[model samples]
Target: MATAFKQIEDEAIEMARSVAYSMPIEDIDMTDSARFVDNTHWAFFERLRKEAPVHYCANGRFGPFWSVTRYKDIMAVDTNHAVFSSEAHLGGITAKDQEDDFILPMFIAMDQPKHDVQRKAVSPIVAPANLAVLEVLIRERAQKIFDNLPINEPFDWVDRVSIELTTQMLATLFDFPWEDRRKLTYWSDVTTIDVSAPDAKMTRDEQRAILIECLTYFTGLWNARVNAAPAGDLISMMAHNPSMRDMQPMEYLGNLLLLIVGGNDTTRNSITGGLLFLNENPGEYQKLRDNPALIESMVPEIVRYQTPLAHMRRTALQDTILGGQHIKKGDRVVMWYVSGNRDETEIENADAFIIDRARPRQHLSFGFGIHRCVGNRLAEMQLKIVWEEILKRWPMIEVIEPPVRVKSAFVKGYERMMVRIPG
Candidate 1:
């Protein structure tokens, strides 16, 4: 089996080289697969995972981007912050929308000291200890959303279940009015979508404007709470915290935006992705039904399989060599976590979905080192709730229609999924 897979991968390598070298450099982004819901993108990632693990793509949709597939290669890039830094000086963590001299210094794009300061401000609230308080609320909301999924009919799971549940959770956490929860998802989607397609509805400038307006309003809410002598909300937590030294208003806003989107979209997609996977692999779904106890172990497998965030880009701080590839100072390195999680070298029986694996949660989806997802526990808790409620309410689900993937590769998520929910 191993030898056969290797032969197949080698053939794919040659195919990729022929395609990459001959293709026009002008169009190299992942947009081509936006509407194609099948696993073509995953197939492309699988090919790279085997051949030229850290290969380069000089021209594509994102344009002249470096590709880092395979588990070890992604781990190498993810762990070495000093060598593969997130500083915008190199190019931020993305290959597109890069302007000449503009900087959007979110904490995710900065190195220590600066990253440390802003990260520290929000650390207390998201820590496992503090976040435990919200599990009840999160679980309750997830259950309500799952139940409303039309147990006997077909519906769009992405909008109704995924987006709706996640937005409500974000609103609850951010202290935003419940009616405005959808706006959080709206902003997150607009902000994360790549500004490349000629028909792209929202431009980066427009997104920035919306982001600024939203943050200004949030800041006002935080201020009102502060002036009222009771900082009860998440914004209030940040604004009134004396420990938040040297944190600028923009930094605060960036962090807020990050939390709103990060907390919402990734988890939402994971939910939809998990359900869609289970629907496609009914045998695996049946296996889970038989071993319902495996849900705990399955959480990690779900994360590994779905890999909510497709890729994260980093810039080289200085001239360095990665897995024999010459990475010069200021060169951007893109790490494809989706490919890494599926790398056969690291995972035995890498292609199959195994929920009962001994160590299933081992993937770079939540990232690594200091920048690892702070809300990982909350995300897990949410998934657990969904699965728990799923088995309790309805034991069988059918994929009436194939899932539709989001347009952007940044977040490889379901834009539409139709399933038959048997009550």
Candidate 2:
């Protein structure tokens, strides 16, 4: 099975090279998930940023769309919410078009007054005071996880550390049952999994069933919270806030997915990605060891380097010109955060990972404008705390094998990575 998978990956890489290198600049398609799965999409984006920053693909898995690759252009598209709508009824925020029946109306996918109202309802989860409280808990959890590791024995760092830490954090935010915290991670995976991927164990129907299970479970919690006094937990906050309390059942499910994916994928993948990056760039790791304070800057650098969530889709609300191209009303526009993070013009030495660079947080990892990740600071906090705890123990965590990356362009992350630490 391993040998067969390797052959498939090799063939995919070869095919990606053919499409990315041999195709004309105008004809190139950046929406192919295979290119992302094989990690060959970087070259394509590099070419697009150089030749056509606002390239358009006539046909793609998600149909016709414009690829905004350069740093400035991506920012322009991301910040122009008036011209580009994220409304679920239009297309939501993925490359695939959101069908009406499958539409999930979360705040991130809404516009104007409605978006602000819904967003404000749950904003307290990452508020300054709340974060101060979460810090102590996060540190303690990190220390415990590190203390329990089987020293010198290879284990899946992604499963044991990344997922575990993030799952615990998510449970805290939701005030979920501590023992059943892993369910949060499972539902997150089901919410974002690409069933067409070769390694995806569940069918589309099965995936939807699991998501339904998640919605049902959370609904019970919502019912309990809605009747109780206001609490600091996310579910409770939503339940008590007037702006969110009257949300439709579908809206409730949508917001649940947003919080789950936001809370789970961003920090968890970055934790795993940072470890792999440190192994690849040993000098940066050594620098980090020499000056532990570098962890402060390194957290954002890791987020920029990994780019956990790749692209956010928006539908052109009105006919407008962007980057010297005429965009018709209702055209699909995709801002590839993964590509913009590597734009050399805005980010110096963009392809390399530097731990203590000036303006470390200037990248598009968390995006810009109103739709920027609400949990960005919290994600940074978790990464910082985990690294602080990690450095106090082992000198290094060594990757024993190549990581199995998730086969999707949407969620840029690791499925498994084997690592060992000093005994």
Candidate 3:
């Protein structure tokens, strides 16, 4: 049965590759979420990187946009914040444009002095001293989680491990109510869900309503934090910070959602992806088991291999030449970090899931330049602690079936992955 599944999967990948190569370069729309759901966006990206590194999609789902597929090209766009903007009014960070009524003016979508100041407000949460403290707390939580998993029975790793751990960490960051922690996971999903997809849980209007509920809930927390003395939690930090204290309601909600999704999705998906990658590459799994110390490097490799948050969008502030292609002012540009991370011209054996790459940190998963992910160190610590605890407990956690992937070009992740642990 497993062999049959593997064969079907391989055949599907071949078909995807064939279509990707046969299609007209101008007609190749990488924003099709169906391709992402089946993990076939890889073939599309491969073709783009080789043939048209800075290809334009004239009729994308979210309208016309430019796709930056190569590593160097993506880096150029990411670093040139002056010419390529991330302003919310200009569509924000995702490939899809942010609706005017629901615009979330978070720091990531801002340019220049505003972005720097707002980001600085929450920077202390991942300070070296805070991370050291979090390390201990994370390890304790991981051990408790693993201790409760059922032995010799299949379970959804996405729910049992990935989402649970990351959600718990997010709760800690926000100092949220323990019983309502699962709400964080829900809000994060709503924040990134592609509403146009066939399987969308709700319409864009519905999603906005739910997110407003999230804002209301967080507003209560913000009000509480604002009244109290300053503390280490993210909400309290923002509440006390002079730069962030006077943010508008939508802006406050936007930043809250940013931190939630940032803290939730990237780490959650990477945890699940690490297990799937290990099972696919048994040799690397054994290498990890043989030298548990490799966890240090393995953590970053997992993040790169997963490449969570597949792309970040920017709008051209003015006419610019990227990779010899002319981009006009106000044009939407998307940097495919997922493609860039896998660019063979840049990283040696970019497709392989080797755990011990000499320079494991050389990947675009956390992005580049000033707008990079803020909670990166804390994310690394969480993954490291989870793996360390897993090594000590279970010799192997078998992936019984392929993961059910999320259908979104922007958020590359899994919905569920069934797994079993030998007793």
Q: C-alpha displacement of 278 in model 2, angstroms? A: 0.7
The residue-level lDDT of candidate 3 at 83 comes to: 94
Candidate 1 local lDDT, 1-423, one digit each (tens)? 223433454465555655554544433344344422344565566555655666777666655667788778777888888888887555676656345444556777778877777777667667676667778787788777776677678778788877887888788777887876788987788777666666677786886788788778787777676666644456766766674534677666666777887888899999887876676566778888988888898887888888888788888778988878898887778888877887777888876777888778777898887678878888888888778888887787666665666766677787787767665
Candidate that scores best on TM-score = 3
Off by over 4 Å in 1: 1-38, 97-102, 228-232, 242-246
Model 2, global lDDT: 0.88
TM-score of every candidate: 0.88, 0.95, 0.98
Candidate 2 structure, TM-score to reference: 0.95
Candidates ranked, most accurate by lDDT first: 3, 2, 1
Q: lDDT scores for all predictions?
A: 0.73, 0.88, 0.92
Give the C-alpha miss distance for residue 81 in model 2, angstroms: 0.8
The per-residue C-alpha lDDT of model 2 at residue 324 equals: 95
lDDT, model 3: 0.92
Model 3 lDDT-worst window of ten: 1-10
| Whole-structure CA lDDT of model 1 | 0.73
